[model samples]
Every structure is written in C-alpha cells, then in structure tokens.
Target: MPADADIRERLEAKAFELGFDQFGITEAATSEQIVAGFRKFVELKRYASMEWMAERIHQREHPQNLWPEAKSVIMLAVNYGPKDDPRLLLDKKDRANISVYARGKDYHDLVKKRLKAFARWIVPEFNCDLKVFVDTAPVPEKPLAAAAGLGWQGKHTNMVSPEFGSWVFLGAIYTDMELPADNPHRDQCGSCSACIAACPTDAFPQPYELDAARCISYLTIEHKGPIPEEFRKPMGNRIYGCDDCLAACPWNKFAQASSEAAFHARVELNAPELGDLVGLDDKSFREVFSGSPIKRIGRDRFVRNVLYAIGNSANKAYLPQVRTLLADDAEEVVDAAQWALEELS
Candidate 1:
C-alpha cells in the first residue's frame, strides 16, 4: 500500500482544528475547460487594472507550473457569512456599506496562519513538503475549490458552497504527497440570475463572467486612481467592497455566521458613517484599518471611495468635508472631492 495514500480524515481533523470550515483534496490538475475560461477572462481584458493576473497567467494554467512535483492540493474554506443580509445597508445613505469580507480582520493573514499551521503538521506527519496560499498567489482558488468539491463558482464568479454559499474564503495547500481527489462539485447556479440582477454596474458580461472594470469592488479597491464617472453613481455607499452579488445568491440561505472570531465584523466597521470615513487621514486610516484588508488601499484611495459615497449620499452636511478634501494632495482625492462637491451642489 502507498504510504500516507489516504489521510483525508487526519488532514480534515487538523484543518478543522486550525479553524477551517470545510476541507477537500484534489489532484494538482487544472482541467482544459478551467484553463480556457481563465485565459478567456484574461484575454478579454476582464481583469481590468489587475495586471498581475495576466503576468501570472501561465502559473495558474497548471498547478505544477507554480510548483513542480506537486501531487495534490488541499483546499479549505472559511465561512465569513454575515449575520444579516449585507444588502440591508445599501439604503442607509448616510452610512458606509463595506463588503462583508473586509469588515473584519484580514482573512488572508488569518487563513495563511492556519494554512501554515496545517502544513507544519502535515509535512512531518505525512512526510511531505507543502506550500500554503491564501488568495495572494496566482492560484485559481475558486476553480480549485470547486474541483475539490468545496463549491461551484456562481454567476458572480465566486465559489458557492452548498454548505457555506458564496461567503466562504478559500485557501490552498499544495503538497508533494498525492492524496485522493474528491469528485468535482456540480454547478448549482442553475437558472438563478438573482446575482446578475444584483450587480449595480452590470459587471457580469454573462452568467459566469465578470467585467471587473464595471464592478464597484474593482472601483473601490483594485482600481487606484479616480474612478470612471460611469461607475461612480452606481457605486452608492459601498466604500470598501461590494457584497450585493454574494448576498443576493439564494444559496446563502444555508450560510451561518462565521464561527471564527477573527472573521467577525469590528464594532466601528459594521456600519461606519460616511461622514467619519471621509475624514480619515493617513495616520488615522492606518490606525483604524491596521488589521483589516482595507488598509491595503491606503488613505488616498480609501478616502476617494468615501467621497464617492458621500456624493451619492445627497446630504449637504458633508459639504464642508468635501470642500476640505478638494485641497488634498492626492490628485485622485482632489478629483473625487470636486465631484462630491458638485453632486452635493
């Protein structure tokens, strides 16, 4: 018998101990369809300003390209489901509506820590070498997770678990030891177009493709400069990320609030006021978002998002803040401030 040929139980035991919600293993192979879909996503320039996707296209083309001698990939999911429908915040014109994923401590840091712990246990127990990844790498996590039977990629192009829905965060453990692969999860998105209608910017070109340039999440977090005028109005109060598509999915009805405290929404961040977020300076922003994924955008870009929400707020109360931000040093901030001021006028 092959040594450590079957350790799914032990693997899942440790993964659950490390706070992961779901676990599955799959051979390190990307199907031709998966490879082509990713290539098309890049070829059609749907990645928008995220040039890294194109740069590492081949790395994601196959798991072995990123790590030779890899036999299997362990996929894990962390449920970050919100306690309430995140869409509830959309009509709160005076408040900032951050995505469910970013309202807490950064999942990348937390998940990577758990993945590292899991790796430390497996390398010695199973006599294998492994590398851990939590969204930072060129790994096609959604497809891989689906392949591992964790979930299907919904219309929003996010992994949707029957167990946890679209609210799960995926992580990977690529190992030299081969493990039994799980049957791929079947697509259950079916005829549901709720996620499609939920997009404020019509970011989905079709049922399963995303045009990031039109996504509010892209406008708020990924795209660094002044947001294009067209997406700004539709962005509404989403000051950090957008959760509409995820929240709109009917599969989410089965999602429970995350058991991990690290994934819980911070008190102040749950529903911060746009008036407050717009006033964040570099120092304050860092202090506020120190452990949050939001810190990556820095004050200029974050405040720019806040200003757009402020403009969409239709409240002249923020007029003074907008006027002051017009004198900000960052060209983008100044541009957003001017736009906010005009909208308020």
Candidate 2:
C-alpha cells in the first residue's frame, strides 16, 4: 500500500523526534511563477559571479529533473534564531559581524545528518526510494519549503516562517512515497519594508527582488575578486556574511532562540575582533574556522574580507596587520590590504 495522510502524521512526529523544528510536505514539482522569477533573475545577471546557479537552472527550476520518480518532497526546517538581535554587533566597527547562521556549527552538516537519518527510517518502512539533500544540490529549497507550507518567501527572498520568522535552516528529502501535501503558505509580509530598508548596500532593486551583485552576504561569501569601491564602506565589519535584512524583520520579535544546542553560537566566532581575524595566515585561519562554513572561503578570501572590515574599522590599530598582508601571496588579499591602507589614509 502507498503512504497516506497517516504516514505524514507519523513522519512529522519522527521529524520532531529527529531534532527538526518545523515540517511540511509538498508535491515534487516547482511553481511556474518561481521558475519565471528565477529565470529573470539570472537573465538579468543578478546572480553575480555565482555561475553555478546558471549551470543548474533547469534542475533547480524543476526538481523532477533531478529525480524523475520522486513523487513527494519532505521539507524540514531547523530554527537557528539568535538569543539576541544580530544587528547590534554592527555598531562595534572593530568587531567582525559574522552572519548569525555561520556563527554556529555549519547547518549543512547538522541538517544533512538529520535528513539522512529521516531517509533511513522512512525507506525501510515504506520501501520507497529516496535522496536527501542539504545545500549541496541544485535544490530550490526556499521555494520548495514555501510550497510545503513551512513559510512564504519574504520580500527579501528568504523563507520567513511565521513561527520561526526568518531564522530557519531548510533541508529536503525527495521520495517516491505518495504522501498528502499541505496547504502552501501565502505571503504575509503585509506592508512592512523593514528588511529592505535595513540592507546596508541597497541590494534590493524592488520589494521582492535582490541584486546579488550589491548584496553584502554574496560579496563576502561568494565573490572572489576585490571588494567593489562603492560597497567597501557599506561592507562595514561584516567579515563572513550579512544578516541585516534578517535581523530587521518585525516577525522576529516573536521568534525564540533555537532549542537545538548544535545551532548555538560559538564563543570565539560570536563577535570576533577584526584585528584578530586580519592576521589569520592560512594555517591559523584553518584552525580558527575548522568546522565552520566560513572555512570554505579559504584563507585568502577570508582574510580579504577581514581586511575590508579593517579598513572600515577606523581603528588604525589594524594598520600594522594590514601592512603585513600587503605582501601576501594571494592577489585578493594583497588588493584588500592596499584598499585598507588607502581607506586609513
């Protein structure tokens, strides 16, 4: 017999047992509007240097392209809400403001572990084929989560759970099990534009669109080249990623800090000093961010980000560190060091 609504109830209970905070199910299909919006986003080159996005556009727009036999998608969310507002650290220009999500253990590792466990539990009972994914796949996780009733894509283009606000990490399990789908969540942003106004780089060209080229998170985390002159000052002390839009959501007022201990902020990364980070040679950088997502950017890119923050700090105490990195092997790091010196001058 195929899985039914009863299976969904059991699965949801099991998801909670496995440490997921929110759960929903949706058909293994993509929304046409989301597909169009994504196409337009790439067509206009809003994805910036994220060429991988263009590479997998077809698979991303239609999840079925990834696995033709999958009949349902189990969307799960883990709340990683901070105990305090993440925006507060921005004022301390000498402190590096890592994104709230990156401060904790990498969610990819945490969420994928749960996803694999859930897939294992379901496969034996239902005899259904399944595949688990975190962020590695070309999955349209946010849109799929919205389709599964986890939340609606907010104006900032991140899924905003009414319960968790904008602080959820999404993971997916694609399965052939024929489970009932939930009602899709409708956009509830109302008239609030707090998220848009809070962006330091004016990344939003419109209420629901993001020009990733100007987005601090993308620039810090994804872009490999020199910091654009226009955005360097606005980059502030954000060394890894930016959370200004997420922090400004009024819905977050009702959000609670994550119950999952794995999501709690690590002390060293919580509000690191820019001076401390600017001096990270490749060896020290690896040790400092061993298991964190920030490590993926490597020492050159990581220190490059730190140098920009150093320039923004106006602390001059960082001058010696900046001057030392001026001779670094990586051109990106050397370029950032030069920029920092000019900014300080």
Positional deviation of 75 in candidate 2, in angstroms? 0.5
Residue-by-residue lDDT tens digits, candidate 2, 277-326:
88878899899898899989999999898898889888887888889988
Quality of model 1 by C-alpha lDDT: 0.91
Worst 10 residues of 2 by lDDT: 1-10
Candidate 1 vs. true structure, TM-score = 0.98
Model 2: lDDT of residue 284: 97
Compose the digit string of candidate 1's lDDT tens values, residues 139-169.
Answer: 8788889999998998889899998878999
List the pairs of residues colliding in candidate 1. none
Off by over 4 Å in 2: none
Candidate 1 lDDT score at position 318:
96
State the lDDT at 276 in candidate 1. Answer: 81
Model 1 misplacement above 4 A: 1-6
